[model samples]
Target: MKGLYCRADAADAQPKFVIQETSLPEVLGSHQVRVQVKACGLSPLDFKVPKSVVDGCYQFKLSDKKIENRIAYWCEYKYEWLSVCLYVRPKPEKLSSVCVAAALRDALCAYTALHTHARMAVGHTLLVMDGASSFGLMCIQLASYHGVRVLTTSHSLQKHTFLEQLRPSVARVIQVYNGSSDLLPIVLEETGGLGVDIIIDSGVRLQEEEELKETKCLPHKHELISALGVGGHWVTSHQDLQLDPPDCRLLHLKSASVSFLNPETWTASSAQQGRYLHILKDILEKMAAGVLRPQPEDAVSLYEATVAMETVQHNQRKKAVVQL
Candidate 1:
């Protein structure tokens, strides 16, 4: 198996990513299935996997699950779309992992965060803090598809046009320049003083530590308490958590919570990953029907994964798709 691999040369250090020929375990789990690897979504998870596992989630299904191929039309969601409200790196696409799954992996993660973790409903209002980023783009689209009023923030004016490709509802895109502080007023005003039902922060421009302390993330005692609804959920990406841990005490007042996306921590049997797969299968139909627009994909040759990964590292837009 020639795929991207990540392993720390030093035993005591963090794992770093590299592209090299790697072997897959000969023995397979009963639940696993081998994919032809026509295309695989490249994401941070690819580098973080500590093995040669790319987000080959594109075009694959678990052996035990009863997901009918699009041609067969097994059990699939009759609904127009499935919306999700949370955060980060694309999952592999449908059939393949677009969960044909590019940006779909990222979509699946958003779907999982919104549907499984946050318990998103049709009426829920989701605040996507980095509405223009690739991760944020999927979140916005899925939320809109499921009839959720999406409140998204974008700091980069240049990307606003691209963000519009996700098709957010009109007047819903809020521009925030000063990080959480600037976001305070916008969120408060948009949801009619009710705040957002959920918030998914996709590594948006984070404020400095001093600024973070001043803002205090929906401060427990401040004018911004209305930014987050009572008992709302905020799902921040794993990378962002290293820099900005949310204000726990402040969240406690409203009985709100902040969770990070770290699939590495969850056991295989845990419902968290299982639920994502379930969400993946459900939305595969939408991807096929064009209900959930596929985010732009930058396809690269699998043989050139070394160069492909460099693009993935600094990818500002377009989901990286590795064609094997």
Candidate 2:
């Protein structure tokens, strides 16, 4: 058996990725399936894992658990664990880790919107922040497929123009400038004075070092809490809300719920994970059947691996794969 390892050699480090040879331990359970990893998707958090900010931002303890322990959690519960070891990389160009990420994003958006947010009801409106990217576009398509209206926002004018050309499921496109003004009014107007049933804020701003330590009133935090509908939900993979703004009564007042979609949460054995996996498998099948398309693969390589050191750093929006 073979695997990838994160190495530490100051001069040799180009980026925090590595590939290596290793032997697999004997299988200890009948339920475990030894998957030959063909490819795996690299996320921004993967690059940030080595940084000090990750220690405070993410949910899992990198130093406390083994890779196998984390994998077992995901296998048992089907929660999306970001801290997963790549066991096998599938063959062929069409089936790769990037495809898996796209599938997962599609599934997450679909499930969160239809089942969790809107309860899969027809005619519900979905407002997606930063809707031009891969995840946002998938959310639009999935929501539209279920007869739901979608409204999205983008920071880039060029990207917005390009998205406009695509003629996606979007009912309206708004370009947000200053954070002071209320964008909700425009969103409500687009929905005929009825506010959106759901609002997905993917670009959540985190606290600055000084503010994180001292401030009680953060502008971005307040805006987010105020943006939600009477019973809206905010989902993010970046920061843990429980630790931030503990005094903010928004969670109790407007029925606002904040959930962190970290890798650890994905490792839970709850029925939700099964539902997510089912949705993901279905999306992958759709892609395999040529019913869906994704962004082109631009692969990046991992140079080496080492224990005790962080594995990824400064990850931009790119698809990275390790050759084992």
Cα-based lDDT for every prediction: 0.56, 0.51
Off by over 4 Å in 1: 11-34, 45-101, 164-171, 177-181, 204-226, 238-246, 263-267, 270-274, 310-319
- Cα lDDT tens digits, model 1, 153-242, are 666666656666555462466655434455677777787777888887654334344345323332222223247799988776646343
lDDT by residue (tens digit), candidate 2, 1-324: 554443333434553434556765574344334444433444332322342322222222233222221111122111122233222112223655545543444445555655654463577777777777666766677677778778877656776785676565677777753333356577667766646666666655455333332122222544555556666666654454444545257657777676554443333323344554555556666556544555554444344322212322442333343432
TM-score of each: 0.67, 0.64
Per-residue lDDT for 250 in model 2? 61
Q: Which candidate tops TM-score?
A: 1
